[model samples]
Target: MFLVESKGGAIACMLFSLLFLGTWPAVLAFLERRGRLPQHTYLDYSITNLLAAVIIALTLGQMGDDKPGMPNFITQLYQDNWPSVLFAMVGGVVLSIGNLSTQYAWALVGLSVVEVVSASITVVIGTTLNYFLDDKINKAYILFPGVACFLIAVILGSLVHSSNASDNKKKLSHLSSGYEDKVVYISLLFLSWNKGASKDPENGKEVKVPAQFGTAEYLIELEDKRSIKVFDRSIWLGLAITFFSGICFSLFSPAFNLATNDQFHLLKKGVPHLVVYTAFFYFSVCCFVVAIVLNITFLYHPILNLPKSSIKAYIADSKGRGWALLAGLLCGFGNGLQFMGGQAAGYAAADAVQALPLVSTFWAVLLFGEYRKSSRRTYILLVSMLLMFVVAVAFLERRGRLPQHTYLDYSITNLLAAVIIALTLGQMGDAKPGMPNFLTQLHQDNWPCVLFAMVGGVVLSIGNLSTQYAWALVGLSVVEVVGSSITVVIGTTLNYFLDDKINKADNLFPGVACFLIAVILGSLVHSSNASDNKKKLSYLSSGFEDKAGKIAFDSNKGASVDPEKGRQTKEVAQFGTAEYLIELENKRSIKVLDKGIWLGLTITFFSGICFSMFSPAFNLATNDQFHLLQKGIPHLMVYTAFFYFSACCFVVAIVLNIIFLYYPILNLPKSSFKAYLADSEGRGWALLAGFLCGFGNGLQFMGGQAAGYAAADAVQALPLVSTFWAILLFGEYRKSSRRTYVLLVSMLLMFIVAVGILMASSGHRK
Candidate 1:
């Protein structure tokens, strides 16, 4: 059987599983919203769900040469492993029930809320159990912290839902009272035939109804289009079911863990532990059995006063059969991948994927428009909840304990260390023994230079913002290379002239030529990678088109294709290999698809220009090359200039980010200042990032003042760090064509050579 031995491979599996699992719920929800019977949908889903397991058994389960300890899937089928098999079956049963409960809960609670709550509960209970079962492979400090984050996210999610519901209630009340005086007309149309009207009678004439939130009219429209009758249900009922589902979900993973590992020594001595494939196959079979029995029972005797259905009715219902089938395939494969990953990594770490609410919230916003026009408080809670989930997942993904104390503790310790070093090791000799420090000097003179420093900060802020978008558009490696190269070539040249050409001209000019060459190679790399991605997208589109044709044929014979069906078809086409790219685009606050590559390049160029100016501006602030200040005024020290620079940078960044929250460019969703203030997640990390940037910039300026400023531009080699992370963490260049890889390597090499040459030209300032 195939095995994922490497940590990276296991991580890849878990991430893919997370995407697939998160997506299937949205599919099922969509079908339900389109009025497809849950009974029929589940039955259709069950068939493909079992089929997916069988497909895995035949393919990955039997691929490698069989060994004694780890038998192939088919061989294990005949072995005497009923004890482990029972455990697997039990896990399947629990998972099936959890899925069934969620179908109803989704209608009562919002999709995002339900997902967050259930996932949080699952992580809290299931991850702990799995940690013990896996012999505590996961670090308790990191794992528990992640679990705590999820718990906080759960509370925030609940508050967000409560606030949003209150908003809807108020909207409906106002809407009802506003139209109370209008001439009323209630038409008794056939419930099955009429699609419902969006008009209100006024003065014996039909008037178009305004957009609604939660009026009786809106409820009726929802009831007409939904399979489950949830208009009269209380939110309490949903929460109760959600809790139950979470409990069930929490147990299933542990049961599966026992089945595969036999960690408790439940089976007899001779019976080998069940492999992942055998366990997964049995698990799926039992899950399919449970789903079939329950859904068939529900068909004959419906709940929530839903119309009764029969086996015959279910067979005849083809309205959303394709989607239901697709959801099953997604869920089945998702579960298999999760199990495979759990077997390689500890199941406790694999539980990180329970942060699926992050993905669900993306779909909820993009597809269902769940939080559109929500209250400021609701938006704030929603963003905070998502941020907490992200942090929690990051913590879970870490493989080991932190080296020292907590991040905050280490940061504080470092600060104290720096202060001690500065007081002792950084003392000046007798020549400047009585001189005041830079901070005191700031108040005495060179106040006008602070303006230049603040201007530098403004330019840096703009460049930083632009680079963020550029990273998403052009890959990180290219963006870093091009942006850094621009800074070195332009900013370094300006600094050399500003410093009265103290640096060696021959070496500096050669370094500038190297940077220009690196820039060209960076552009070429981006173009090649873009072409590769386009080809991949084209292949996915072609395959999906064929599937769409079959769907159209089925629709023609079974049911008339409506606009909703058309939209679903279009969305489904974006699934498969390109799903990650599509999901990333949807999840981002900024929307940039219409302009694509050119827009990214434009932003990068603009950022490069901004970046190119900041250094020169700072140089002028410290050296007073333009003599803008009075002759008697002392030139600003590095520390004084940096203090003004960072202060202005902070102000500009806050103002712009806040503005973007409300009046965002690139078609981003609207936000408010309240939401900005409400975001508690990652705030500490954000402060840390700002602190590091300020400290680093101050040090760079200090070094440049002693040596030639042009040599200090070598810090622009930051692309080296960024590229390493882009490849290792984000998987930026995976599966790219040979040509793209070649250009990428060439660009990096040229950039390194250029940085080294620039540093070699360093000259001592008099």
Candidate 2:
């Protein structure tokens, strides 16, 4: 609490930074529905490293080094207007906390009124307190208007809530109910199936009700296939908390700015500008890293526990205006604002007093309507929050506390923000409303995935720290606005392509419009001068081809052989040569594939081959390259490009996994991670695929990490390895198709490319 004051709302501003940062966390929640798979869980989120950084920065910003250093933004804000800034920031934090506290009321009450009630209550109390605390009575109009706004918010929330309830009740008459609400529809089905068993007299006839047009048998026999998949409230609560925390996180930019600006102002002058900027920059990096990673894991929490394939809705319902689009806009602008503010000012302030549940809860209630009885509470909360936020703006303005208008000058930037926000909104709407995103798929029942997810969580913590810097550098809205926009726009486009049905819709008004827009956007992006510059930058492309030719030649005939002249072809190769072998020219020169690509792939491929062949190649190449044999570098280095690729795969895998995770949560049967193993139907031979995958990964890990360059050079003997493995192991050849053969040839070409890049970089005497 004291730190909040010291930080001058930077911590509060983090609410926004953390908000957009929550996409991954939401995804994690969707994942829990899928069973059998070890959940993608990360422990890093529990730790708030950026929050710690904020505390430190806030405290340090306040006290200064005391000797003589200070950041100018802080000094500027503090020296010119300490009182205005302090009071305004304090007001923001308090108001934001008020908004954050009753955030869930949107679901409990109604969107319109939840904010009103919360805000009215808060403002009323705040006004009363202001009479004594600030030595000024609140303006009657502002105070009364807040109350009225709260009332209006309440009325709207109630109306919308009740209307929704009626619709739900009617719908519920035909659907399955969970533990909370019991429905007798399914049992009736069994009863109606029986003919003339009880009520019918000696004839195969159906019983009937007086008012019912259909027979009693028909009433019970209605073939309703609707069911509801429910989530554990405990899990939901956790997800909600994370969501709330994200809203609170959004305010960090403005809040911190208010806190640190004053401190920087008061400082005398020993602090270097670099130190000031660096403090915020490092803070941002840490915050962002944490936020990014935690976001991923948090999203997995729900789907990991859900019944498979339950999130999909069996619907004849009309599609309404996309709410996800709104969320994306919020995320993008929110992030962009933080970066802008933090960059411009020495501090970033965050406070989410009015942002809670607004975007997300809106979707939860309207789209799914799962909260049940809280319809009233949700209304109240929404009403109060709205009123409070509105009053907050007015009150803030009345106090004349605007951060000396920094956003107006740049039209291009603002336009960029708008388009990004719009594009993102559609994307967010298309997201799988369930949890346990693709990243969690990378996690197996074993420890590798667990370890990676855990490490990922740590990275998330660090990223959250980066957000603080984003705020200090840019502004709160900038980060969310820009980042969310990017995510949403891309996601929306992908969603179009991801679903065939959705793509079909592209022929309509908004759909066609979206497609054309995308095309134009693509053109803008591609037609830019940068595209040409990118082509000109390809001077090394052809050189790689020639080098590939050489490697292919050596591997084909053996001229690239070692000069030791001792025994016959020794398997023990040297490190330099191993690295060199990968780069040698071949039948297919390095011209197209290039060295870097081959090196990455080679490690990705037969890394295990390298491990076993390590000692064999030891004599062929230089000791300097295979130096790992003496030490433990072998074990450590192997995980490099291999695992990073896993992270990349998670990005796509989450998409498929979400489908698997969602269908189960929606109570759809046959939804499972095993589905990921299959092609179209559930026909993928798991044992075989697993072995192939495992073999592929193990080789990469052991060979890349453990083998010296010389030992790795042993891979130059692909022909020998291929021949032996091909002939000896029936398993390897059993699945070999024409495609596989083609791919192998490509790999051969790539190997040569790798050698050439190395050679070119080496500057040969020739």
Candidate 3:
């Protein structure tokens, strides 16, 4: 009654299979993030994957002597069919490209969507290919339908939870920023049309247009076409890449199986383990070679070869080196396990393992913070999708072993069940009236919050843009460090230097130091290796809230309408606003440094210095020695300053959106201006967000006026306010891994200490 043949064994294998495969994809995500940072490239990924395969091959190569008839794994590989090895290598090349594209998909779409799509594709293709090609396990009836059902579920799930466009803004924003220098060729006819409109005479009765019968209407039509093309291209590119990657994933197992099958004489019929290890080795070699060629070609033919300095910088980047090595090991080992598992447990066990999208979806939600607070329809869709995967595994494993029922009968039954479930879920999830769209949530009440946010946006726009420009001039890490330090030190000093002479608390500097240290630690946590208790860990967090201070915190819960929950008023009680949380998450990650970082740092340092001046500038406009704004506006000083700032933010947002419409950085779709204006689903929320943001900004200014800017900013480090809300209201940290909890607690404690220091430093009250 081994686990492979027994029901219990199958279950155990499925769970273990998730560990062997589910978590490894996340490492690739980390590598992709490195691609976005300084001194990293696909070459690094290639090198790392090769190294991991080598390590595993070498390790497994040591073990084949256990079998009496076999030579070592390496010897067997050379002794096997040369064509088989070559084909395996070719398969590896396809896989490597696919793997790279998988990361790209993750970056472009998200973990959950890509996981479902790719896993579904792999199951269908791999199951069918291996079943017919390999003698390892044979069950066409159960396998085909199960895989089909899985595919259907994936489609339904995708439709249910369409890409959260707003959620992806941060990741996609960089594309626009990176491509800021790239130019788009536009038709001159539109320009001519605009010019004619501008030059219309006072009589305005007759402005002759071109003989082609062009007019304002024609311009509008042409503009719409251009916007739709850009928008559609971005969407199509992402979908195409995702599809290609899925097909590539499907080929890996079949290729490896073909390489090692003794019947095919693809490789030597050595010890089973030795064969598996050899297959991996051949695959890695191919991956490495292909990666090198592709990357080199990219640098040379497509884009001019990067300067030697950039290449050197990439090579010299030691920071991501460790992560890359770790990723390679995980990936190589994971593949090896799949091969071994296929050999040991049979096709049922292997197919069950292939159904890993469930595990991936769980991790995507918990670790990456996706799908939180999604609509009920999304929840149902996700559940339905998971159930379909379960059905797929159930039938896929019973393939050749059915005693009473025919394969066709089981397949039809399973297909029907999947269709019924998917339909039920889809019908259940119809977009109800009150769905959270985020674009149309504006209300009269939200205006104040929107106003507040716009004010904050205005107050911070110059500093923010300067920060972005500085990153291009220098690099991100340097700018962050310099900006953070200056914002703390200079802003605090200016607040203290104010004419009111506010009492200074003693913990100001210490608090700032502690928070900065914490920020560094939190960055490390994201990049840190997981603890050894990896198998026992569920990828999902337990969605439970601590009730200790629930009653006390409940009072602060604003009667805000829940976007995901529909138009119903829901309590969103928390100290931190959404803006604060977004900003906090955005600023958390820290990258490894390179030579380019120095220039970026220098620019960032100057920018940071300028950033320090903004808070003081607001302070001055409100109530200063010059009273340049305060005296004139008197009671409306705060409002006037905020009004100006909001206007700035509005202008910048509009200009940026307009620019993106023509030249999309992230390759996102561009809608016509009419479409944008017509879409009013979440305007209330937008205004509310803006208003709340403004309040936060005004409060910052007021706090700086009362305490030193250093003290006020130090208090900003107490991000736990938002964390608590994310937990209680959003159930964010439920049942997370111990390491995750440790990271969370560490971040929380650091922020607390920083806050304590800031609080202690704010000596006397106003």
Over 1-766, each residue of candidate 1 has an lDDT whose tens digit, in order, gives 8987765567557766877898898988888878988889888988999999999989999998988789999999998998899999999999999999988878777789889889988998999999999999888877998888888987887787778767655644543443222212122113312444344545564443533544445544555568775634556777888888889999999999999999878777777799999999999999999999999999999987789999999888999999999999999999999999899888998787786676677667656667777789988998788877776776643211111111222233224323432343233333143344554555665767788988998999788778767877797889999998998889999999998999988999999999999989988888887777666556445543343433333332323346755533323222223444444444444433344677788888889989999999898988888887775566776666766776677667666766666676665556665654444333333333343455566668878989978989999988997797577545687777899999999999999999999999999888
In order, candidate lDDTs are 0.75, 0.32, 0.51
Off by over 4 Å in 1: 175-220, 397-766
Decoy 3 TM-score against native: 0.41
Candidates' TM-scores? 0.53, 0.28, 0.41
| Candidate 3 local lDDT, 385-455, one digit each (tens) | 66666666656332111111111122222233223322332234333352211222221123433343344
Instruction: Please give me the total number of clashing residue pairs in predicted model 2.
Output: 248
What's model 2's lDDT at 223?
21
Q: Candidate 3: lDDT over CA atoms?
A: 0.51
Full candidate order by TM-score, most accurate first: 1, 3, 2
lDDT of 2 by residue, 27-105 (tens): 2222221211111122122123234334434554445433233443344333434333443344334323323333333
Clash count per candidate: 0, 248, 40
Better of 1 and 2 by TM-score: 1
Most lDDT-accurate candidate: 1
Q: lDDT: which is higher, 1 or 2?
A: 1
Worst 10 residues of 1 by lDDT: 399-408
Off by over 4 Å in 3: 1-17, 31-41, 64-69, 77-80, 160-163, 166-233, 262-274, 299-310, 347-349, 373-379, 396-766
